[model samples]
Target: MIFVTIGSIFPFDRMIRAMDDWASAEGRGEEVFAQIGDGSFEPRHMRWVRRLDRGAYAEAMASSRLIVAHAGVGSVVTAGELGKPIVVMPRRAALGEHTSDHQVETVSWLRGKPGLVVADGEADLPECIAAAAAAANAGARLATTADTGLIERLRHFIHG
Candidate 1:
């Protein structure tokens, strides 16, 4: 299943709407499910809930073949730890989706990380999703542990 989530703090209607439209256009509605948050735009093509409980949320992530979500650190980190491929769409402040454009900056910083793909705008979502799904289907996976270099650097920074 393709699990789509907009974190608990804010409503991300644009991302939700884009995914909903993509599901409809691709005829993959049944395969898509969403945790939409407080978004005003209800998904017409796929199943969705306003919010998911912790257990349910974890289950959805665990079972999904691909995860589509807003560019939040928690979601990105969890996806990496779970070895799941994720497509992230940053919430834009210019659209009043957040208090600032930090999400966009976060996406920029996370650009080349394993198992994470960025959808810069609604129009970019479909292609990003497709690429992430294809990679997942091809057995590409994120490492469940931190990179060796990162770990070593942290160790040195802390203990030196």
Candidate 2:
């Protein structure tokens, strides 16, 4: 299964459609699930999650073989924390999917990092999925992450 998320901000039809195409060519029994706005559009291959519990999202994230996303910071941070292998495709401004092109910059940094894989588009999802599956199978270790003085530093900066 491939889990596709565009975060909670805006619609990302391009990423959605790309995953839909990937679902068709990848495997017969494979699943592609996406989170979109209003949830009206439908492609033959993929599934859309219109309204589901956060638990459902968490379950899918934990269980899915490959996690495909639109380069949102929270999602990327969570994936990194979970040590989940991710394939991120940035949301383009011209696509009318986001307020700014920060995702483009964000994905640019994330793609080269460990435990994350960045895909070009839906056309690349299948191959990316295979690579992700191989990585998952390989049992590679992700980085150890932590924030030691985040709150204290923030408070000091604010107060000072």
Candidate 3:
């Protein structure tokens, strides 16, 4: 199963529409569950809900073979912790998806990281999804933990 999420704050119709179109064309027969947040476009090829609760979200992440998500740190971090293969499509400000291009910057930084792939646009999503699925099937694991030193520093900063 593929779990698609666009986070909770904004509507990412472009990503949702692309994924729907891709799924419809691919005929992979994989079950896709999407968490679309206030998006106007309804997915025709995949099952979707307006939002998922925390427990439901966690369950979806844990059960999914691959996670297709927006380039948001929360989703990325959760997917990383779960060792899930994740394909990220960043929301663009120019397309009215976001107030800024932070997602683009986030994707830029996260590319090449283990278990993470960047789909720069709809054109790249199919390939990225295929790669992610293959990697997952090959028993690839994402780097879930930060360096010990960084962790300690963060702890110290929080405690101090």
User: Best candidate, lDDT-wise?
Assistant: 3
Q: What is candidate 3's lDDT per residue for 1-160, written digit by digit as tens?
A: 8999999999999999999998898836888999999989999899999999999999999999899999999999999899999999999999999999999999888988878889999889999998988887788777887878999999999999
Mark the regions of model 2 whose C-alpha exceeds 4 Å error after superposition: 144-160
* Worst window of 10 by summed lDDT in candidate 3: 22-31
Q: Pick the candidate with the highest TM-score.
A: 1
Rank order (by TM-score, best first): 1, 3, 2
What is the total number of backbone clashes in candidate 1? 0
* Model 2 C-alpha lDDT per residue in residues 74-126, reported as the tens digit of each score: 77776766778887888777767677888888877666566677776667777
**lDDT tens digits, residue span 51-133, model 1:** 89999999999998889999998898889878899999999999999999999999998886667889999999888988887
Q: Tell me model 3's lDDT, rounded to 2 decimals.
A: 0.92
lDDT of each: 0.89, 0.73, 0.92
In candidate 2, which residue pairs clash?
Answer: none
**Candidate 2 vs 3: which has more lDDT:** 3
TM-score of each: 0.91, 0.80, 0.90
Question: How many pairs of residues in model 2 come into backbone collision?
Answer: 0
Total clashes in model 3, counting residue pairs 3 or more apart in sequence or in different chains: 0
> Which of 2 and 3 is ahead in TM-score?
3
